[model samples]
Target: MGEVAKIKKFLAEARYHHQEATSVDMVNVMKQYKGLVSNLEPYVFNDGTCRKLTNLSGTIPVRYKGNTYNIPVRLWLMDTHPYNSPICYVAPTADMCIKVSKFVDHNGKVYLPYLHEWDASKANLLGLVQVMITVFGEQPPVYTKSKAPYPTQQAMPTASPPYPVYPGAATPYPAMPSQAMPQPGGFPPYPSMASETPYPPAYPPASSGYPPPQQTPYPPMQPSPMASGYPPQAGVGAGGGTITEEHIRASLLSAVEDKLRRRLREQFSQGTAELETLRRTNLELVQGKSKLEGLVGRLDKDCAELDKAIATLEEKEAELEKGLGKLSSEEPIDIDEAVTTTAPLYRQLLNAFAEESAIEDVIYYLGEALRRGRIDLDAFLKQVRALSRKQFMLRALMNRCRQKAGLAG
Candidate 1:
């Protein structure tokens, strides 16, 4: 290769990138954002802030979780478009209510970590959508099909020069030429040997231009080990060579199956754990209820016994009241005779009741007179003599009553 060849190659590469940047009719806007444009009808670059008025669309089939979900997107370029991230939205279907989620709101406002940490100098529309597919995967969109499962989940986190990797591009984001089509899923299927090497088999014509220059003589081509070997080479051609189409397809299938299995296992484990916990909690609740019932039963028994005791006491009170009523209805007792009769009874009771308090009962009536200081010496002597006579009377009364009882018996 000569200096002229290097310059030509550089020019060709530059031309290729230029065409990619302006694939849409809105070259000014597309050049700035490098978006995949959806041109509506007559091709024209939209000049104003009103993005809808422009004949452009950025629809793409986003692949996620092994499902190809078609995300029809529209870009609303801002007045300060390149400096700031554009307002993007995924159009809703007429039949389905779009589920509001962290990444995409019901009204279609996206809240992505990339957007939160946006950098205008290096970000582009293609990169934005690529990241959208990833954020949406965390909580996937409902029911439309995506182009394919993610090219590589690991590819999503990279943000610098975050353009979609076209067939030849090194970066993970979508920066491929428009020839890139949405197959069943994924940006581009793994390349074959021919695609793995970006240049064609034949060399280009020598460059005629000057300012930029490059020249490196090409070496003769050799047969790929893949085709040369007895069996096809391990990958593409050699063991460590670029990924082959077959390998990509096999990997996708295996990944889908593995994801499904893992999901099922997780659901089963979670349900089983919940059931065990519920059973334990239920056991505790039942035991607590049983203990409360026992305590209530004991209280009921005690209440019933108390009620019976009250009823028995009530009966005794009623009987005593009835006896008193009958006594009141009968002739009034001669208090004097009653006193005379009860005098010996009191003495017998006092003698029989031998507790220490019996002596205290003696001074009961005399206490008032002593407190009043009403007894002079003469009065006290007279009262003493009268008390002596009463004692003699009590002795006669008891003897007479005993004789009568003996005769009657």
Candidate 2:
């Protein structure tokens, strides 16, 4: 998978994320650390809160002395990343030993000014990496382990020293490796143990840019027989013996083992990347399922409401059909007779009320006509006043009739 894709997947699969800003910052940060391998790993905090957080593990180039060396390191992004600083550590290999210094502790945890003064707005992984490279150059975090055998404590005759010792010195000691001296500008050069001797080369630096660079795995350093704790060969042995079949077999087996180990390491890394991708896919599937379930629930609710509305419409349609049939069966009636009141007194009141209603409609129409310029304003006023007087007289008569007929006005 692509580096960006891998970084996104790592964030998505992480057990906990404090905020969106953290994820956004992580994307940009991961781009800078393209050489590092990103994955979600469980981390236990001081308070015993175990959480799976995104981590970038691998080596970054540190220029020490006059050569560049890949320093193995790991960075863990906190749940509240960008806002909080990431935890960093020196990851030494089996053949190497950790060198405790001001920047690195006995436990391999890194400490630096940049990390201590981390700013959410300005501080980033790239800056932190640069700081690490500079600090590690001054004081290398790790060194190759010595494989020389220990001498017996048996008392023996003391021989003259091959190398002259200084005054007050009990025994001669090997010269200390020269410390890296910074140049006028740029980073300090790195020291290489394999440079002087025929030891294998360390891992190379990973490329980084807008277009993600590929990670080229460096060949693992092969162990020299002298340092590998292997028995002396041929004339080198105490008894000056020739090369044997057993020795050849052992040598061949070691070479095969190294090849197998390198292959297995590559395969393991590939499997891990694929597994993370699968986890991301699974998470997406689960989210999609939840959305589909919610949509289906809403659809079911809408269907139930529609069913009720359909039933009410059906009832209304039946009532309308029944009324239509009754009207069809009835004979045609005179409009005036059809509207007649039950009693004579009520009939008189109804006629007066009808006249008052008619006058109100006439007055309204006259006002509308005046507004639309259909009648003059003076004629509209005179006609409205007359209609109003008639309407008042008709309303008074209707009230009296209603009282006599014992009906509500």
- Per-model root-mean-square deviation over C-alphas: 28.3, 17.9
Per-residue lDDT over 1-409 for candidate 2, one digit per residue giving the tens place of the 0 to 100 score: 9766666677777734554565566566556654567778898887999988888887776666567677778999987777789999999887766655456665788877798789988997778888898888776777655454222233222344444433533432212111211123222233454322333234321110012111222222222243334544545532343223444445446545644664565456445645654665588789999999999999999999999999999999999999999999999888988897778888888888788888989988898999899999899889888888898899889889978987766
Model 2 bad stretches (over 4 Å): 15-34, 149-409
lDDT of 2: 0.65
Tens digit of per-residue lDDT, candidate 1, span 1-409: 7433433343343332333233322344444333334332221233633222222344444444343444545654433434566566666554333334445554565556676566767776557766876665544433333334233233323323322322533432222122322232322233222212322111111110111111211111223233333443333432544334444444445545655654565455445645654665588789999999999999999999999999999999999999999999999899645643346655553333333233234334455576688666566556656665665565565565556545331
lDDT of each: 0.46, 0.65
Per-model TM-score, in order, reads 0.29, 0.38
